[model samples]
Target chain A: MSHDTVVTAAMLAIGDELLSGRTKDKNIGHLAELLTLSGIDLKEVRIVADDEEAIVEALNALRARYDYVFTSGGIGPTHDDITADAIAKAFGLPCDHDETAMTLLAEMYRRREMEFTEARQRMARMPRGAAHIANPVSTAPGFIIGNVYVMAGVPQVFQAMIDNVLPMLRTGTPVLSLAIACPYGEGDIGTPLAAIQKAHPDTSIGSYPRYIDQKFSTEIVVRGRAQAAIDAAGAEVHAMIGAIRRKKEVVENPSAEA
Target chain B: MSHDTVVTAAMLAIGDELLSGRTKDKNIGHLAELLTLSGIDLKEVRIVADDEEAIVEALNALRARYDYVFTSGGIGPTHDDITADAIAKAFGLPCDHDETAMTLLAEMYRRREMEFTEARQRMARMPRGAAHIANPVSTAPGFIIGNVYVMAGVPQVFQAMIDNVLPMLRTGTPVLSLAIACPYGEGDIGTPLAAIQKAHPDTSIGSYPRYIDQKFSTEIVVRGRAQAAIDAAGAEVHAMIGAIRRKKEVVENPSAEA
Candidate 1:
């Protein structure tokens, strides 16, 4: 597959619990960080309910737009676990039990002397002509159909599956970031920061404010694939903050003591 | 404004930091929970980069689909903050500094002996014919244009603005939920649970699995507006779990010693 200059991806978080606000989503952040480190840009994320139409629409939209689309949740044994079927429908394929997945799951249950019930067998189903993604935590494997990779919603299982999935995908140049903490509010240095950002168009500068210990501060981060550009922009940010602080101090307490 | 029988909402989280995996989002969960408590259904959520085109495209889609759309982040004083502009363009309205918002911010800065810089004044800009949403944390207020409520990405300010915005909107009947936890995996009782779900079409049932203390368990939640319906479904859920456990025990521990 010919990839773009910047390898990009999108995430689809499918579940009624997440939309209902009953479950605080933990997979997106984890996946985002992992993808960044692996040199894949996470461009978009859409959280939809377990409804099949919602999942299919989002799956098609994301898979067509990005290089890869990863879906979390709704792959369990329960009826609400409908991501496999949705992905199948989105790609115009039939969903059924896969022999490899069934063998893996059946053996795992047999080793534990547990009856593999029909409901347990539901986890072995996958879209036709799809390859399974190994699950380190549980034997029920996730599968990949087209550019869409389906994984579990459980954080541990999701992370484990990501470990298996990342090596299979192509990686691009990783983005390097440098953070500089300034003891000033965002408003104090917003103008200079914008100028610095313009001076280095290759690097993306971000300003995040923090109000802790009864003091206001901002953390400015510079991100890009080039280290030289990041360093140049980071130095400009440091100098700008110093200049602002010095000007504020000299004007505010200009007494004979100076 | 009149709302549909189901007052649905969509959230747009606008920021480069979120997409870059530098910041873990907190506002979505907070808003989802708050909206649910206020009898509003949060149906969809989209996390997009700070790019104006992306923001505008998502805003139009979400606002068109849902009853209300809430956006968080990118309303700060920095150059990266383009939500106000994107929102204005989405509605084909003019973006400018509102007299009311300017006065609120100017007065707050004056009282604190702070200079209201041009960058700080950027927070006062809103789409024409917009209503400002009060920000108790910082004087830089959010705004409401059409059905979209734009608020700060900072969790503190976002929560405060939500407290102000909820009362102005019409609320529907709240959905009450009951949870029943069983010491078994989802597959252990998924078939019976689905039967229960099919039997009670009015209630929405969610199954979430957990692995803690080296034990597997699943929590089944039933949600609806009617107490009688929830109670009836809750009883079935309890009985189904009991029956599953009893059958498993009888099959595993069969003995004629008794």
Candidate 2:
């Protein structure tokens, strides 16, 4: 029941497109999976627009509360990219062009034989005291300031940066889960589910109703720290579901004489 | 460059399965669309676990900053559902079983001839001085306390509740968008895209790179309040893309292309 040792993290998805529904925020799900695998509990995920004040507020609040904060978006070369400035304001620091970032970016442009315009150079600016997060895919590297790590809004780049950063993070014990799926509705098996939940107070029983093909099916998932308890609770759920199904079948097909 | 009047909102998605990667949180995208269509700027979104303290802290911070806050999940018959209690604690109010909620739930159960156990009755609890937000699809109704509206975690039920509650909300002028997509990578047209963005300071232009059918594609979206301005910007982008494509085709096939 006590999860005090859980190493929790938060996500900040910064984009106006996500808010407008033009683009679905895929970074949250990716980060959730990545963090869970790394044994870092993703306690919270947030999506904010390109606005400076909103970004700063969310950044400050999340960074203060969670062990680590990962932000995706508002780091591109466009005018809407304001994450670097906002992070600076959140930390009460000045945003300036980092020479190291500029040198790396300049080298990339030179190798590709592309002009390093002012707009492209804008990507080189970071919060005064921050280290660069390596982006293996693109030339524009993500940055980390204090507990907050800023990455690209693009899924592939963001994922690569996360993979690069996760190994260095301290993690806790990985979580384990067990589930019991049946061809029944939640209302039909609510009682037994409640009983199992009450009996195993340490485990969490989640009832999900899924519509597949033409039928409604329910999946009751039991998750906990102890594997033995999870197995026992899952067995109880299966027994209860089997009994209910058998009873219903008998009632519907009385004698099978026809 | 400046929005004279901005009515911002935040979405809080609550579920541990999401954090554990067992389930992807879909409520944020749906809520963002709903809020945007209603002319309320969905400025921020947060996904948190069923933990009470985390939910309470996020609720307090978001509700205080934004004009409205919409929270999904943790409002169920299960013990893990702690959204109501958290909201109450956040507002420094006492939570108890409401007579009105009980009556509504009892009616729903009676109509379906279902047993209304203590666990089922737990859905009738609400924070004091909160108005009920109607849930058309489900028996468990949501509640509105101050700026925060608490609803179910299920996508269909949550969306329906938002539809029911949105008509009554006061909203600002809605932002509109126009987009043009082509079968080319963003890297191919970064310079011109940057130029267009610089020219249209009022409009936010986003360049998204998508991989479809093993081919790279990019979608340039222009968003702003002015339809005429957006139309002009879209026209310029189309012309720029057309020129780029023509030049590429000419270079690749000098003899057959003509």
Candidate 3:
């Protein structure tokens, strides 16, 4: 798998609860992980409030920029749920209840002996010429309009929808990564790390700092589609870390913590 | 303080680690909660990879739309830390090492008997004519340029910077909320709930469903700055729930779950 063959994606999270801090978004990370496993690159994520204009603007921007745009929340049976209408406006299409979605909801309600009200039926609405994304948790189905796949906010339901939708989309080459951790601050290794990154332009190297057991440590990860590139980059980073450790022994007095 | 005086903010979380799903974001939720307590409305959040163009685009858009734009990540001492350069480009200002920030970092390093390298000094760079946001966790100081505040990616450092910067900004009237949970699905109450929302247009009502105890339940929350409006809307919701319960008893067979 080559770097040029990578498929790209973007996610739009729609809800006032998310923007207001009432809800900590779990779907974005979940989708990012799922997309990675499916060989899709998640390029960007935007969380906008439950405003029609905001939703429409973000949806259009992401759909145009990426191969796929996944949206979560704002598809419920509430008054504030306006994702379907907003997505419709983004594509210049009319949004209405789908027969398949409505039938599924009706049957589920009938089994539970609950009345399928207008609000519940609202979940059936989607942009014209959209394909339905099956929901195994609840009968309310999500839909795919253009490149955007609208999903529920609930964690369980969203994951279920992803499981159903993943097989329907095309996957690309999976990204591979190698991580090397050393008990040193980022500043101690930043210079050489940059050189290693420059040497391996195809692979992206990230330095993440962690404080564990009252000791500063850094984890450097090299990621790329090419195994040889990743291996070369990883070896350089490992050598760099070893040199930095030897330099610390010669320059600074060794403390028990160090 | 009134509805018209509400202060709004947006957040831009920049990192490849986040977009790759290697790190679950902790700063957005923390900042959202902190801003809410300080009477600031967090209206939007955008997460982008470690790309300069993406950061500049999002920074410009969010800064223009909201009263304040808060950015987290990419302010580290690593090569991928390009946020400062991107922010400077966005504001059409030159990015240089701030004297105050550099002085602080130098003193901290000197005390620890460590040399202040160029990579470490990279944290001192900011858009020209920007004020510094102190980082108590680490010596690397964040900065405020125009309405956008650039902070560290590390959660501890980001939170400390927020603590230092929040007092310098203006806050609005605190928003209040009231929540009531009922064992009825959103569909069962959507019709009357819409009427309640219409009656109190100033307040926002959100319906969140939960699957608990093998039965479906809904939590309706009304939020606004006005207590009287919240009470009025809340009373209507409570009354509607009671009416729906009575109607359910007459229409369907009683069940232990209901």
What's the best-to-worst order under lDDT?
1, 3, 2
* Candidates 1 onward: DockQ, in order: 0.77, 0.39, 0.72
Best model number under DockQ: 1
**Cα lDDT tens digits for candidate 2, A1-258:** 466357889988898889888888888888888887777888878788888998998898889999999999978765667899999999999999889989998998789665677767878889997999998777688998999999998888889899989987888766667777778756567667888889988777887666465344677788776788799889899899889878777667877424
Model 1 CAPRI quality = medium
Docking class of 3: medium
Candidate 3 lDDT by residue in tens digits, B96-138:
9988988999999999888798889888889899988887777
Kindly report which residue pairs in candidate 3 clash with one another. Answer: none
| Full-model lDDT for every candidate | 0.89, 0.82, 0.88
lDDT (Cα, 0-100) at B4 in candidate 1: 26
In order of appearance, the predictions have TM-scores of 0.97, 0.84, 0.95
Which order, best to worst by DockQ? Answer: 1, 3, 2
Q: First chain of model 3: TM-score?
A: 0.94
lDDT of 3 at A196: 88
